[model samples]
Target: MLNTPVTIIQPSDGWRSLDLRELWDRRELLYFFAWRDLKVRYKQTLFGVLWAVAGPLASMVVFTFVFDKMAGLPSDGLPGPIFYLSGLVIWRYFANALSAASNSLVGNQTILTKVYFPRLIIPLSSCITGFADFFVALGVMLVLMAYYGILPGIAMLLLPFLLLLTMASALGAGLFFASLNVKYRDVGYILPFLLQLWMFCTIIVPYSEVAQRGGAWRFVYGLNPMGGVVEAFRWCLLRGAMTGPGNANATWILLGTGVPVALFILAAGLLYFKRLEKMFADIV
Candidate 1:
């Protein structure tokens, strides 16, 4: 009789020992997970994908009425609708991505116990699923821009970089919170309130407002990561129309501060997630 070979698997040790090759090998599973999330999100919903456009659209209307009409807030010299929608679209994507990714491990607890795959895939897929909503909302923004006769300028070329920054920020924060959620469970409850506060702190109103305050205020706001992304989105998409407090100098300040902070969060989150990876199946 021929001898049979047995394969053994063991947990990795040390910070630098993470096997990213495994994640690359499991790319197919990642796609399936992302597709499953996209379908489950719209399943049985009456409006289907329209639900993606609705949230940002509704917020734009309220912001237009309350901030532009009532509070008399500035629109950065762009049309009120497009101005608010610009910020709303980016902010909504990050907020939704962060929320979904943070709960991914706990939400899919059964699968974690039954199988072995890159645990990072759960939160990463949730973030990727948010791109569906982002593109839908972006389409609505383009329509509004056309209606307003606002043309995108050469600055629009920076969109891909800005978008990468946004996704990185969401993934970083989500991984951190998702890991915590497995043990504390209260992370799920506190996340909504925290996101609400984060939105207000960011340039949901206008970068001009934050920039005008200047000094430590702008520096602190840039540390939020999303603040820079929102500003860059406006700089890219609304460059031809924006006339308020925005300027090239402000954009530089925002990017310089936000990019570094976002990179830090992403690195830290990955390290923390790897450290906790071995215990997720048991705790989750």
Candidate 2:
């Protein structure tokens, strides 16, 4: 009888490293996790996917009324709905992704205890699940833009990059919190308040307001990361419709400042998450 070779699997040594190739090889599992999250998200819900469209639309209406009509918050000279909805969609995605990803470890404790796949896949799938709602909300945004005859310019081409920035920021924050949540659990409680404060810090108010500071304050505001994302989206999609003073320099400054901050967060999060990945099954 011929003897066949045997294979043995061993844990990696030293600091945890992200094996991109292994993740790629397990892409099918990632798809399964992402798809499962999508189904589970809307499962048994009356509105199903319409909840996605409704969330931002309803927020847009409330903001338009409160900010535009009641408080008379400037929409950068653009119609209230479009201005508010554009920011809402991007903000909604980030908030949702962060919330879900942060909770993913505890939420899927059963799987973690029983499975051997990469732990990173869990939070990653949560991020992708959130994108499903984002795209749906994006469609609603497009319709509103058409209703107001707002046309996207060549800058609109930057949307994909801008979106990547949003996702990176969310994932960075999400990973950090998700790991912390495993041991502390307090992170889950604080996330809502944090996100609320974060929203106000972003361009839910007009970017023009931030630009008015016109110095270090504006630069500091740029460090918020989502500020850059909101401005980029508005610059790309609402350029022609915008009615306020434009600052090409401020836009560049925000993007420049934001990109580095986001990158730093991502790098830190990845390292922290990797450091904690081995303990997830035991802790969770």
Q: What is the C-alpha RMSD of each candidate to the true structure, in Å?
A: 2.4, 2.4
- The parts of candidate 2 lying over 4 Å away from their true place are 1-14
lDDT of each model, Cα atoms only? Answer: 0.86, 0.86
Best-matching candidate per lDDT: 1
lDDT of 1 by residue, 61-118 (tens): 9988888888898778877788789999999999999999999999999999999888
| Clash-forming residue pairs, model 2 | none
**Per-residue lDDT of 160-182 in model 2, one digit per residue for the tens?**
89888988999999999999999
lDDT of 1: 0.86
